[model samples]
Target: MANLILYKQTDLSDRMTVNRSHQANGGMSLFRTTSWKRSFVSSWLLRLSMFLLLSLPNSEGKAIWTAHLNITFQVGNRIISELGETGVFGNHSPLEKVAGMVVLPEGWNQNACNPMTNFSRPETTESWLALIERGGCTFTHKIKVAAERGANGVIIYNYPGTGNKVFPMSHQGTGNVVAVMIGNLKGMELFHLIQKGVHVTIIIEVGRRHIPWLNHHIMSLFTFMAATVACFFLYCARRPRMPSTATRRRRQIKADIKKAIGELELRVLKEGDKEIDPNGDSCVVCFDIYKPKDTVRILTCKHLFHKACIDPWLLAHRTCPMCKCDILKA
Candidate 1:
C-alpha cells in the first residue's frame, strides 16, 4: 500500500515539476497557469508591490510614481495626427501633430527566433493590427524591418517559450513600434475592440511592481551589495588586514568551500548524527521552511510528517523516526 502511495506521489511530483518549469520558463501565467507556485508567486509579488506603495505616506503631490501610456490612432491618407492622448502628454514636449505611430502586432502569433518576414514585401499595412510571428530573431530586427517597410511601429506576439511580456524604448529611441512596449494580453484584446469599430482609448498606468519572493533585479543588486559590504566590515573589525586583497581572497575561498560543502550535504541528504530535526516541521538540512499541509511519510518507522521535514532530518539520524536507530547514519 505504501509503495503504491509513494509511486503515485512520485508521478504527481513529476507532473508538477514539468508544469512549474513551463510557467517559470514562460509557458503560462497565473490566470492561465496550471500550477500553484507560479501563480502564487506572481500574485504575491503584485500584491506586495501595491501594498508597499500604498503604505507610504503621500507627500509632495507626486505620491506613488507610476508609468502611463495614452494610446491614440494615427490614421489618414497621408498621416492623420492627434491620437487618443498624444498631444495631451505635454505641449512643447517635441511632439508635433503625429508625434509617434503604434505597431499592432498579432498576439500569441510570433516567436523571437522567427518573426513576420513578409511585413516588408510592399504589403498593405491596412489591418487594424499587424500579425507578427516570432522566431529566429531579436525584437530589434523585427522593429527595424517594420521601420524600413514603412511601418510606424511593431507588436511581437506571445509564444509558449517567451513569457507574457513587453518592452518600451522611451529613453532609447523612437523607432519601430513608436517607442512603446506592450504585452499580448492587453494588445490582443485592444485589437478586437478596435476591429469592431469600438473606440479603444486607454490610460496604461504602470504602477510600482515589487517582487518579494526571490530577488529578481533591483532587489538582488541591493541584497548582494549589502551582504558584501556587511561581510567586508564585519571581517575588517576582526582582522587587522581584513581590507587587503589577501583577506578578500581568503574570504572568497571560504565562500567556495562553503558552497562545495553545501552541495555535498545536499547530495548526501541522509547522513548520520550530523542530521537531526531542530525545527519540528521544517527541514533541518536544507533550511527549507515547511507547512503543515505538506505530505507526511515514514522512513521505515511509522512516525510521519512532511517528506521535506524528514529528508532534512534524515541528513543525520537517517534512521527510524521513532526508534532513533541509525541505518544509513554514516
Candidate 2:
C-alpha cells in the first residue's frame, strides 16, 4: 500500500511539470506576436507623419507679413518713375505714404562716430529729412543717432562696393518715422539731384514681396512633385502595344506589293522593242539600255526594266525607280 501511494504522487508531479512547460511556451509565442504587430504599427505611423510634414507647407516659415517702399520723385513737371529700389518696410511706422522733402545731412557726414549728426525734427518749421551713407557703423547705431536728433525719416544709401541691390535693414533702438535704404547708384542720383536744387519726395506703402530662402525651397519642392506626377501619368497612360492602324497599314502594303509582283507582265523583248536611249530612257537601276531578246517587265506606270533588275528593286522599295510612285498604292 505504501509503494502504490508513492508511484501515484510521482505521476501527478510529472503531469504538473509538463503542463507548466506547455503554458510557458504558449505565452512566449503570444508575446512575440503582439510585439511584432506593435512594432509594425509604430513604423507605419512614423512614415506617415514624415510624409505629411514634408508635403505640407509651413505658413509661418515660408510667408512673412511685411511692407515695401514705393519711392517716386519729380523731375521738371514730369512725375517719372524715379523709384529705383524698393525698401523693405521698417518697424515703428504706420503703413501709409510718408511724403517729405529730401534733405542731406550737414557736410554729408553720416558716420555714426561723427559728432555733428543732422536729423529732421518735428518742432522745426519744415519737415527735417536725414540722408545718411552706409558703413562706419551698424545700421542700428546710425538710425539711433538720427532718431536722437529727431529725424522724421531716415534714408541710408549703399556703400561704393555694395551693388544696386536693396536689402532688408534691421536696427536696434531706432525710433523710425520712416526708414529706407537705397542702392548706391540710385542714392547718388537722388543726392546729385537734390544738390542741384531739385526737390524729391518718397512714398512708403504696404506691399508684398518674395521671402528669402523659404519661397525658393517651396517652389523647388512643388516643381519636383509636379514633374514626378507628370512622369507617372505619362508612364501609366503609355501604350504597350504597337498602334493597330500602323500595323494594319504595314500588312496591307506588304500584301499589295506581293500581289502586284505576281500579276506583273513578263515578256521577252525583240530587236524592234529594244530601241532604247541610254541618256534619256535607261533602266535607272542598272543604268543600261534594254538589249534584244532580254526578258523584261513593264510596270503599271509604263516604266520598263529587265526582269532581274526590277525584281530586286520592287521587292526592296515597292515603288517605281524613275517616278517613285508606290506600286502597292496604285
Candidate 3:
C-alpha cells in the first residue's frame, strides 16, 4: 500500500515538473518574438532617417552672400545717403567692392537687351554703372551689353510689384564682371534719381552669408522625423500588458485544478470487488472494463473512471465525464 501511494505521488510530481517546463518555454518564446519585432522596427526607422539625410541638398557648397549698397546723391542742395543690405550678387559676379556713377540706357526701354544699347553719359566719365530693368531677355544678355560697353558694374532690378524681394542671378560666363541685383523698389529709386539728372553714386560691399535652403528645408524634415518617433514610442507605452498576465493566470488555474483532483477519493479495484465484477459498469471515460488491481478515481456522484483517463479529463473539463459532477465544488 505504501509503494502504491508513493507511485501516485511520483506521477503527480512528474506532471507538475512538465507543466512548469512548458510554461518556461512559452515565456522564452514570447520574449524572443517581442525582441525580433522591436529590432525590425528600429532598423527600419534607422534606414528611413538615413534616406532623409541623403536626400538633402549638399551643404558644402559656397553660401549665398548678400551685397550691401550705399547710395549717395544730391537733392536740392542737400546730400542724401542711404545704406542697406538690399542687393544680391550674381552667381558668377566678383565679390570685390566697386563704386561708380550710375547711368541709364539711352532709349525708353531700360532693359538694355539690345547689344547696340548705349549709355547717355559724357564720354570722359571714368567709371560708370548701368541701371537696367529685370525683363526683356536673359540677365546674361543685358549684363553682357553693359559689360561690352565698358561699364564698371551692372545692377539689374527685380520685376515690378515684387516689393523688396530679390534673389541672386545665374549669369555664368560673365568673367571678372561685377554684377548685382536690387529689389524693384530700390532699383526704381536709383533709376529715377539718375534719370532726373541728379548725380548718383553707389558703393557696393559684401554682406553677411546665408544658407536659406538649408535653414528652411532641413529644419522641416527634422521636425517631421522627431514627431514620428515620439508617436511610435507613445503607442508602445500605451499598449496593454497581456503576455505575462495571461500566462500567470493560466498557471494559477492549472495549479488549483491539480490540487482539487488530488483531494478526490482514489481506490484500487481487486478480485470479487463489485467495481471489478464481470457485470459491473466499466470506466465510462475509456469504455474499458475494470479488472483486478486497477486504479480508479471515484467522484461525489459514486461514478468511477480509470485514473489515467479521468485525471486529464477533469483537468480540462473540470467535471466528471459520466455524471457531469464538478470535482472542485464537491
Candidate 4:
C-alpha cells in the first residue's frame, strides 16, 4: 500500500545491511537509529505494542510494504490477494502487516473435477479450513465455495499451467476473507506437509524497512533527545523555559489514556474476547455499547457488555465480535 520511491534490485545480497549501505550512499538513515536503549520491560512493551498496532486489519493501500519481486503494480485488480506483505520473501517484506500465510488443501485436483464431475466428495466444504482446486473455475468461485462452507480463511492454488507471479488477484470480485496464493513451484511442498498433519506456521516478519510506526515513535524518542540537548544548552547559558502546569497536566491525561487503551487492547487481543470483563478489566461488559449506567453481564471469556446489547447478539452468536472468544463457553 506504499507510495514508495521504488528502489529496484540492482544487486541482492545477504552480507550487507541495506539501511547502512543506503546511509553510506544517500546521507540519511531510513533504517538506522542513534537513540539510547530503554529498559528491557520498556523495549518489550514497545515492540509488543507495535506488533499489535500493525496487526489490526487494514484497508488496501493503507497497509504498505516494499516491492520485493518486481511484482505488478496493482490498482483495482493488479495484485490479487496476498495475505499482506509478510507472506512473501525478502528483507524488505515485513511480518507485522501480514494476517498469515495460507496453505491450500492438498489432494483436491482441478482437472479431476471437469467433464461434469468424477469428484467423489460433494463440492460442498465442511470445514472453515477449505480445500479448493486451481483450474477451470475462477478464483472467485473457489473463494465463494469455501466461504459458503463457513470459512473465514481461504487458500487458492495455482492451476497446472499457472506460472509463478503471473496471474493477478482481484478483490473487487469476492467476499472479504484472508486469502493466500501458492504457486506450483513453491507451494507444492508445503501442500504435501499439510497432508502429513504438520502444523502450518504462518510466518509474519516485520523488517526494519517495512515498519511505518518507527517514524512516529521515533519522534517521541527524538523529542526526548531534543529536550536533553536543550537542557545542556540551558546549563551553559543558565536560562530555559519552564514546563507550564497546563502542559504537564495535558501530558498526564494523555499518558493515562494511552496506558488504559494499550493494556485493554492487549487483554482483548490475548484473551480473544470483546464482552465486558467483570474481572476489573473494564467498566463495561464486552463492547455491547453499554450506556453510562446500564447493567452489564460478564462472561467466562472475561468480556463484559450491556446486558441489553448482548442478549440478541448472543442469541445468534455466543462469541465476542472483537476477539472471537466464546462467550457461552465455561
lDDT of each: 0.40, 0.61, 0.78, 0.41
* Per-residue alpha-carbon lDDT of candidate 2 for residues 1-330, written as tens digits (9 for 90 to 100): 122223334543555465456545553444454655444444333433443344344223332224344555677788755442245444434345555666666554645446566543235335545677888888777777766776667778778755555555666466546676666776787778777877666655556544534643565467557655765665455544434578889878778787898788888877655444444466778878777777888898988888899988898899998898888777
Backbone clashes in each candidate structure, one number apiece?
A: 20, 1, 0, 19
Residue 110, model 2: lDDT of 47
Q: What lDDT score goes with residue 181 in model 3? A: 86
TM-score of 1: 0.28
Q: What lDDT is obtained when candidate 2 is compared to the true structure?
A: 0.61
**Winner of 3 and 4 under TM-score:** 3
| Top candidate, metric lDDT | 3
TM-score of 4: 0.28
Which 10 consecutive residues of model 2 have the lowest summed lDDT? Answer: 58-67
lDDT of 4 by residue, 119-218 (tens): 1223442323343446666566566555554555544445554434322244345545544444554445445655564434343333323443454346
Which scores better on TM-score, 2 or 3?
3
Q: For candidate 3, give the lDDT of residue 127.
A: 88
Q: Weakest 10 consecutive residues, lDDT, candidate 1? A: 85-94
Residue-level lDDT of model 1, residues 148-236, one tens digit each, is 55554344444333333432222224232432344445455545545554443333333332222222234435644665576566556
* Cα lDDT over the full model 1: 0.40
How far off is residue 266 in model 4, in Å? 99
lDDT of 4 at 276: 25
